[model samples]
Target: MAQDYSKKPIEELMAEAKGGNIEAQNALAMLHELGLIPEASAAEAARLYAKSAKAGDPLAALYLGVMHEKGAEGVPVDKSIADSYYHMAEKGGYHKAVDRLTEAGVGRRTILLVDDSASFRNVTRALLNKCGFDVVEAPDASHAIRFLQNGGRADLVISDVEMPNMDGLEMLAIIRGRLQKKDLPVVMLTSVREVGVLKKAKMLGVQGWVLKPYDNDMLVQIVRKALVA
Candidate 1:
């Protein structure tokens, strides 16, 4: 059975995560990334991972890097970003990102990852970055627009279904309206298993759907296919 994380408070979550608890760490990171907790708490979660990563935690480093790249502490967003901490974790023989990077080679593919969750964004960002893709991130619709305005171009766009200020659908509409290029590949990551949502997304030209609690192999396959298509 899936662990019930909904009942755990942030402090307890942090404590458990810091105490070598992978599930707690992942859960806390997800909550921080998704804004289920106060935005300020995201920073706290990031701090927890700093310690965890030093102790050879790959997920911790991955999450921290995502938070930094996505500006979890209300910092300005910068897509071409790296986290030394994550690199340190990688150097400690954590092959999660290194393996992907090794297989992906140096030919860079640019990917834009837009989501409200700091944890999820970081984890995804790490995966893509390791896969030899240039990763850009936006917390919401407005941020995404700002990124594009500042000369961001992506081969693929991955976004969450529900978000504050602007949802993925709204962002997709804006992209279609403004970009002269009409065939950009867009994939939606959603926990909402509603058929109506999927149908609407298909109607609106969404290229793919990735369910949450994703399998890394499946994600890589979909991304590779999307980039090639």
Candidate 2:
């Protein structure tokens, strides 16, 4: 429930937040984010907002989404992270997030990340989160296909080229055949520099390729380019 925070002092709000009051956490976050508090800290506001958001506060989710979307004050602009937060806010019954998502033009831009390595997926997921894209992970091609067959939506696909059962190319071929949506963009990630794989990937409409040891900035640029292209 929303608290009657209009009359509450910052000190009281802080105490309440420390006591694990979700409403107070949201209120203090708003105060700090809006600079209503004396010598406010945007970082602290962001931290509180994250906490409240995790606790299922729609307002906190909305605020965090906007902050990350616009890179407000001390926050870095991360559209993918912003997208995730907006999705959470909308699911939590915040209508404003719907409008914001449309305004950002990425409300439906979900990326399917298929890989076998947990560490690679973790690192890539974090990077994609910062880029403000909603990411869904599938450990291998078969899982990715299952996700698609179950009607999960993905605007783009990033798959590791080599995996057990089905490789990225095989998965893409099967996916294309099953979905009958051949224009869907895909990027390949691989450590192997194989002429045959590259040739087939190109023939199969792979949008881009990134080697295993990718530079963060270059990866971000590649993702951005593929998304736009």
Candidate 3:
């Protein structure tokens, strides 16, 4: 007869965690923090979370921040520690860290409003905020991504077709692929009235397209459509 394995002990799980397995570490941390195991240890969980974060796990840093903020299970609450972990996660290219920091009142809605002309970004940001959106200005795609990585969350993205440091099409592709956002609306505002560009916008799943020298009515309509869709 095969030996019975169903009655496994808790010691095996802790051993796996101590052996440098991140998943096992996270699991044991959760079990201990939640009191599902015999010894509920928030400090132990914090240590495990720190270890995982040092190993480049953004989620671990996020959890560490949350646990520190909450002061779970006799642990001292520390907003500074939480902010540090959040910063680390943001620098690791996690976009949701921006939202987290914003919700925590430690940051703001930084919309990387990418346009070549400073006048354009300023005008667009004013208009967007008037319609209840917070905007951050970015001169190009690389700058926009940098802003995003540093805890910026633009509710909507508006980009011009022509610019240095990556064109609108390339930026759109990166946003769609790497941002991991569902129903993230993008509006392509461009001077280029070429049919090919419009067709490509459709192909790339752009929510709206507007030509340069845009009318206020057109802008409002496109923005409404982008938000609704």
Candidate 4:
């Protein structure tokens, strides 16, 4: 899974990354993350780093930890996820990730949770708030947009798809287009299995999803994985 590379050219690196080489993936991800190449893209960097880190590359894990900590474009500010990646790097003998982790002291990450049902919000708020998230409740998409428009700060958004007035996707479009918070990660809580809706959400840059009526542990796990990756 891990092979030592001897300073290959960009073409070679791209080829190796395409062939599922973890080190090559990390190397190319670094070049993209640093804008060292013409094809520099934060989303692509995050995707490559995620693949390498998932395959247990220490350097890739460290870079992902930094991206989560700093809220880089493709990744958001998620201390819980950042710390987990740092620990993975530490286990792989990379001490720099741990050093930076100790240097940055911050509070719990905040999640803007938009749902129309007051009862559902209460349950979700209790669940996430207890699990290292500071959840901000928005009864609907309009309220969510109002909060963001009023200069509200949210590290992530977890919103339900269907509601009385505005659907979550519509609010997501506004968030991506007008609000110009393209990097802000969003997760959808949806019962609809329509491929078009999910594709639209993907085009709008949603990070992940949790189907409606989700298990408590599974929802948290999905949120954590999305936060880091």
Candidate 5:
């Protein structure tokens, strides 16, 4: 069940949020979004939603989707971007996010990240965003594919080898063979040194292989290179 935050003072909620309590963070963000507190601010709500979302809070991510969809409180009005946040929330177990989010105008290249590790996606997402790219994430290959099939956009895709539902090599094959996105750039981010898998990915036209112990700068650089190629 969600935390009961009804009786708690706003100051207590702020303190708990500051202490990294995800539920408290959402509660405080809701207050800001709803103007329930005298000092409520939509910008503050956006910040808290972003923080909690990155930490794997589904509802917070959903709120971010709403923010992006409506351009609320200085967030850009981008339906595609909103859907990206919605996908993130759905992957974290908050289903019912809008599935038919179409492509937004392609000013910034959007990268679809297919990895099961939320922490990894959250960190790399921040890094890529800092480098001027918009990043969307999925927990596995199926989710990544689902996003694409649902009118989601991606300029490049970075996927891990080991996934809970479908392995990355199989995903690459499907992307190349089934989806017929042969020209879509793909980079494998994995620690596996298995030559067979690497060869298969190469045959499938994978652009790059970045190991798990990756340099953030190098990964960003590789993604930039792939987008241009």
Candidate 6:
């Protein structure tokens, strides 16, 4: 008989979590935080994360930092709390979370690209490189905020509107309201053509729009125009 580990029961997992199993706690935290379980509670997720973090789990600390930083999963937007967890994660040897604090800094009109697509990010990065602008990337708004909060600079931001977790408009609102980066130029790259959406972007002070299936030359031109404008 072969043993199957892929089908662990939730009851068993919950029991493990109750028994001080750090990994199980983290797993449960994520499940609730991301709403994988029906009617999942963000508060419960935060509590689980707290337990795991107290046990010195670096990943849990990192996640708590992210949740606090982004105000997601009902963690409440609190940089002080986020900073504490980030520090804990770093001290516990989580390099990626720490590395955000040490981004190479920016030079020569840096561009921040926000999107969830890996291939798109790669292609855009290459294009921007050839255009002679330094490029920084964030898979989502939270990461972008983390980059900026941690000392990364940007002359312009090109973002896709529709994204999981947090959309570009919400990100822009945070950028303008919370971060107070009012003067930053933002370009929207999306396939959406809804009037309501465009109106919202305009109200948010979007500097430009580049529709998807975009032409290489046109995008480069828009970038140039946005930089100079």
The model with the greatest TM-score is 4
Q: How far in Å is the alpha carbon of 81 misplaced in model 1?
A: 37
Tens digits of lDDT, candidate 4, 83-124: 888889878877655554342211367889999999999999
- Tens-digit per-residue lDDT, 1-229, candidate 2: 5557655777999999988898888768756754446787778888998998899887677767766765655788898998888888888986556464443334537889999999999999987777677899999999999898889998889999889989999998887786775877898877867766766776677767777887665455445435543
What overall lDDT, based on C-alpha atoms, would model 5 receive against the true structure?
A: 0.76
For model 4, the superposed segments whose C-alpha errors exceed 4 Å read 1-18, 21-51, 54-106
lDDT of 1 by residue, 86-137 (tens): 4764676544443333346325878889999999999999988776788888
What value of lDDT does candidate 3 attain over all alpha carbons?
Answer: 0.68
Task: Choose 2 or 4, whichever is better by TM-score.
Answer: 4
Each model's TM-score? 0.54, 0.54, 0.49, 0.61, 0.53, 0.53
lDDT of 6 by residue, 104-132 (tens): 22235789999999999999888778757
Q: In candidate 1, residue 75 scores what lDDT? A: 37
Colliding residue pairs in candidate 4: none
For each candidate in the order shown, give its overall lDDT on alpha carbons.
Answer: 0.68, 0.76, 0.68, 0.77, 0.76, 0.75
Clashes of each: 5, 5, 1, 0, 0, 0
What lDDT does candidate 3 reach at residue 20? 80
Candidate 6 differs from the real structure by a C-alpha RMSD in angstroms, to one decimal, of 16.3
As for candidate 1, its clashing pairs are 33-117, 33-118, 33-119, 34-117, 66-122
Per-residue CA lDDT of model 5 for 93-156, tens digit only, reads 7654553222221246889998998999898888777766788899999999888878898999
